[model samples]
Target: MKNILLACSAGMSTSLLVSKMKEAAEEKGMEVNIWAVSQDKAPSEMEKADVLLIGPQMRFMKAKFSKTAEEVGIPLDVIDPVAYGRVDGEAVLNKALELMGE
Candidate 1:
């Protein structure tokens, strides 16, 4: 199972997207553990994640977290603003899968 971690300002904004992503994953028969955490909690959570997706609003934190993600050997990227604004879970999930070279 792939562990997908999303980091935002408060961890609340991504909850809906998380649900949608879960739905998309289920439809695709993919087994994944996805969760969101506040930026402050992300570093601790990264170790358990297979990939890290940062919320558009928290894009600045990417630089800060890149090193840790690199050390963990996971892909890290900012969510597409358009997809994020529309809460397009499938697109985001595809992006994550693409990043993982799936």
Candidate 2:
């Protein structure tokens, strides 16, 4: 199963999106594991992530996370503010896949 990691400030808000993403994945017949984590734990938690998407509020951390992501070979991107604010799981999922070059 593909692993999609979503990281935000405290991991709380993204939890809501995680459920929706799981639903979206299922609708597409995808066997995937998706979860959310705090920015503090994201680096160590993402070793197995096929793709990592950070919250727009934490976009500044991209450069730092980018270094760690490169070492682990995980594609990373910032979630779109519009999509995130609306909690549009399909849009976020599409963005993750796009980042992964899927």
Candidate 3:
């Protein structure tokens, strides 16, 4: 299963998005492990993920997260505000897969 992790300022906001992404993956018959975490907890859990996604609120930290992702050997991307605002899980999931070169 692909492990996709979403990081947000507090982790609460992304919980809903995680649900949406999970649903989307299920619809496409994709087996994926998706979860959300507060930015503070990300680095510690980074190694467990196949891909990392940062929420818009924490967009400014992309540079930092990018470096960490590289060190951990995972693709990291910021979720598109438009897709995120609408909770478009499929779009985000596709982006993660694309970043993973799948």
- What are the runs in model 2 whose C-alpha is more than 4 Å off? none
Candidate 3: tens digits of C-alpha lDDT, residues 11-71: 9999988999999999999999999999999987889999999999899989988888999
Q: Which stretches of candidate 1 lie over 4 Å from their true place?
A: none
What shift in Å separates residue 20 of candidate 1 from its native position after superposition?
Answer: 0.3
Off by over 4 Å in 3: none
Question: Whose TM-score is greatest here?
Answer: 1
Candidate 1 per-residue lDDT over residues 1-102, each given as its tens digit: 999999999999999999999999999999999999999999999999999999999988999999999998899999999999999999999999999899
Sliding window of 10 residues with minimal summed lDDT for model 1: 66-75
Of the candidates shown, which would achieve the greatest lDDT relative to the real structure? 1
Error of 3 at 66 (Å): 1.7
Ranking by lDDT: 1, 2, 3
lDDT of model number 3: 0.92
Instruction: State each model's CA lDDT, in order.
Output: 0.95, 0.93, 0.92
Clashing pairs in 3: none
**Higher TM-score: candidate 1 or 3?**
1
